[model samples]
Target: MKVEGVLVLDKPKDLSSTEAVEKIKRLLRVRKAGHGGTLDPFATGVLPICLGRATKIAQFILEGDKVYQGTFELGIITDTYDLTGEVVERRPVPELSAEEIQEVMQGFVGEIEQVPPPYSAAKYRGQPLYRWARKGVKVEKEPKRVEVLEFRVLAVELPRVEFEVYCSKGTYVRSLVHEVGLRLGCGATLVALRRLRKGPFTLEEALTLEEVERLQAEGRLEEKILSVEEALSFIPAITVSREMARRIRQGRPFSVSVLGSLVRLQKVARRPRVPWLRILSEDGDLVAVTYYPERFSGEGWAEMLRVFVS
Candidate 1:
């Protein structure tokens, strides 16, 4: 039997995100699986793996904020901006005042423009910039606007600094570290990185590969699998009448008048910036991901982005 759910994997170091998903697939013996975020080979923690139907929600998961904790070495710059790349530049470590470093990073707390590292997976002309950087090709990438919700220095070792960051999706910590060094006039490079959270999932709730193997050996692997409903628990669910649920199951969009007393436009979606809502069947099973069209087409109905009826 196939299972549809999400697994929060505490990935071990030296494994790519795709490789981690493959390990989860092998452990569960599932044919279809996907991951919400990508972590570098040297990074670890909170990689959300979606199995079966949960794969449909991977993009939604990717849109959520992420938290990371890592250490960077001062006086060093690498081609990739991390320890994995060759040293491209080095500078003497000047005396850094605690207050000065804090103020510089604080400037990054709000929205800022960030130029991705040349040796990154950012696409340019339909090719990842990393490939071009590998061959010593030059590509000028425009800085993108990203939100850094929070950033704080945890420890200040002379040559290494440990820090934590909470930022919007696609915000690259390596780039952030490199930029900090640039501002200090001393190049820096990331030595270690671990993501502590992604979206609503946290590292504390993730199962390590060894733990997963042990559970499967004991025939209790299902204990770690989060049902599709639980995986989307971040989104509020609204129950629909049987007639409306039938229309959703049949992939037909219906008028809002058919919805009775419990349904109201403001109750389900009140703002013009509403993204998506959970539509449940009469039995409360999640049937489809719906969105109010009143904000767009001025229509009085919920449009289905994807249906999950089974």
Candidate 2:
């Protein structure tokens, strides 16, 4: 069957994001499918699977912030920065208060440079770092800046501490936890992690693999898939006339004046460098995703970035 839309999955532990997408594609019987973001096999929770036409917006979804609740064990350092890797070292857990832990986590807030763990999917010389690590050649990637919106310490139980983090896209919670352990004088390893939110998608609306299979069996799986317009509801949109829609599909340029009051640019602060506008048909079907040029005056013309098969 030809299907299109996003399916939020509560990915199970021990399953890679690619494997999850493959399973969903097979279950839904759709030939075109892709995932919005990558989740470590050891981590589980909200994983948005974009099918058919919905795949076009996957990059936008991946650019959104992510929220995760996780636990880390102090006094143990692992090669992967998580419990899934070989134990690198063991240290004594210093007697510390929850307030001290929170202070360290607070330091990580705002923009901070973080180094991806040696055993990670980060590329090195056109090969995954993990692949190099498996060959006994450890490679340390350059530090990258990632925004940590919130890093609240939820609980402290001596060796194990649980926390929740709200971070920008590309933030590595495992690396964050490892750094926290270092500051505490006891290296740590991530033991558990669950992604609570990704972009506009959340775990509350996600279905498990088994749940999806059952829904497919009942022939109601399609009902849960979110349409392209609904999935990109966070982006600004404008409805164009049938003729204008045709022009957009033909990759034609459009005058800003034509949009008039319909030209609803997102607030300046929230808008990305290159703005995206959803073009809709009179019947409300999404017709195209056009690029709204920066400094676009009322007299200029803008081009379409992607035209949908409407």
Candidate 3:
């Protein structure tokens, strides 16, 4: 049987996210697999691996919020915003209280503009900024707006401050830490980092690579796979009639209004702010994913994003 679903891997440190996915693919013997998001080589924790058809929904999973715990070493600055980069500068560590640091963290909560590190995967003119930086070229990326739902200083020990933050997608925690250091006037850089959660998946439920290898050896690797429907549980489900399901699976689009004309939509009390939805067949299989940008056009059709069945 083909392995198809999601695997939450507890990525170990010093391994890039892509490397982790490659390890999983080789271990599971699956041809198609991809990670939902990227984690820096120095960072480790919840890395969602989508296999087979689950890969199609990886983008939606990546769109979900992320939680990270990281440490900042004050009095130091680096080009990469982490310890691995060259120390660009050094400053004297100033006296700072836990309350003072907490106060500073509170200022970052909510939507704010952030500038990604120069030595980062941020794209500039169709190439990663890091590529340009390697050849003695510097590409300045513009500050982007990101939502910071929570930011708290877990601990403050002299020049070392540990923090935890829950932020929206595309919000670079390293940059947030860098900004906090600048605000303290002592300058800082990320010394350590770990991802605690990504969307509906968490570190607690993630299996380490060793455990996964053991499962494979025990012939129970498939047991670890989470079904496509479970991977999309965060998205609101919309059940349609056989006819609508057939249309969706056949690459035809239909809006909630049009679906109502064919057959009543399973009533969902609350509307989802995100336009993406889980399109389920009458028999209850996830047939496709849809985007309801219906409001943008007079036709108002739920654009068929990906069809699970041909």
Candidate 3, poorest ten consecutive residues by summed lDDT: 261-270
lDDT of 2: 0.86
Q: Which ranges in model 1 have alpha carbons more than 4 Å from their true place? A: 254-274, 292-297
lDDT by residue for model 2 (178-244), tens: 9998988888999999999998899999999999999989989889999888998776677778987
lDDT of each: 0.83, 0.86, 0.84
Clashes of each: 0, 0, 0
Scored by lDDT, the top model is 2
Ten residues in sequence with the least summed lDDT for candidate 1:
257-266
Identify the runs in model 3 with alpha carbons over 4 angstroms from their true place: 259-265, 270-274, 292-299
Judging by lDDT, tell me the better candidate of 2 and 3. Answer: 2
* TM-score for all models, in order of appearance: 0.90, 0.91, 0.92
- Which wins on TM-score, candidate 1 or candidate 3? 3
Better of 1 and 2 by TM-score: 2
lDDT of 1: 0.83
Which tens-of-lDDT digit does each residue in 78-193 have in candidate 3? 98889999998999997999999899889999999988888788899999888999989977788999999999989989899998999998998888888988898998899998
Residue 48 lDDT in candidate 3: 96
The candidate that achieves the highest TM-score relative to the unseen native structure? 3
Instruction: Find the number of clashing residue pairs for candidate 1.
Output: 0
